[model samples]
Target: MHTKKVIIVAQLFISGMMALFMSGVMSVIHMGFTAQWFAQWGPNFLTAWPIAFVASMVVGPIGFAMARIVLRVEDAV
Candidate 1:
């Protein structure tokens, strides 16, 4: 099992990367590949990162549990 520190750090890295890419992609899709898209991407990433981090913390355990269940079922079969 991962330590709490490891989990938190992993969440940070995961959330940051996810937020960065998602913000850039959405900004481009909505605003087009222009100066405005570049302008919005940074602020959008800043806004999204924290929310993504919190959401990942909440959802991570549930997802892990579900994966464990699935794996166990496969093992039993």
Candidate 2:
């Protein structure tokens, strides 16, 4: 039980960190030093940050939940 909890917690943390990194990458690509170059590519570049951030927010929890489920199944076998 304790091990399961630790695994779940670790998975959640990893998923959150991955989500944050993806969001940050989008932010940097859209608003950082490359902003001018990205703008030249298309207007949609301005919208990528928010989209990636929101997607990450949704994906992280879902990923964590899935990881927990998989861990539980593995423990059962």
Candidate 3:
């Protein structure tokens, strides 16, 4: 039980981190691509973290499921 908990925690952490990093990179790309149109859209590039957090929340369970599948496959091997 303790091992399972630890594995889940680690999986969640990794997923969250990956989501955060991807969001940041995407925000940068968006800013670059929309620089010309920013005058109309305004400079709202600082909203990446909240978006990342929400994305992480949404993705956490899926990530955990994938992790479990991989772990099970490894154990079977």
Q: Which one wins on lDDT? A: 1
* Candidate number with greatest TM-score: 1
Which 10 consecutive positions of candidate 2 have the poorest summed lDDT?
Answer: 40-49
List candidate 1 stretches off by more than 4 Å: 73-77
- What's the TM-score of each model vs. the native? 0.92, 0.37, 0.41
lDDT of each: 0.92, 0.58, 0.57
Error of 3 at 5 (Å): 0.3
Give one digit per residue, the lDDT tens place, for model 1 in 1-77: 77899999999999999999999998888889998788888999999999999999999989988998987744332
Q: Which stretches in model 2 have alpha-carbon errors above 4 Å?
A: 1-44, 73-77
Clashes of 2: 0
User: Can you write out model 2's per-residue Cα lDDT over 4-58, one digit (the tens) per residue?
Assistant: 5675566556555655565556656767857564454344433454565566557
Q: Model 1 reaches what TM-score against the true structure?
A: 0.92
Q: With candidate 2 superimposed using the best TM-score fit, by how many Å does residue 77's alpha carbon deviate from the native?
A: 24
* TM-score comparison, 2 vs 3, better candidate: 3
**Runs of candidate 3 exceeding 4 Å displacement:** 33-77
Report, for all candidates in order, the number of backbone clashes. 0, 0, 0
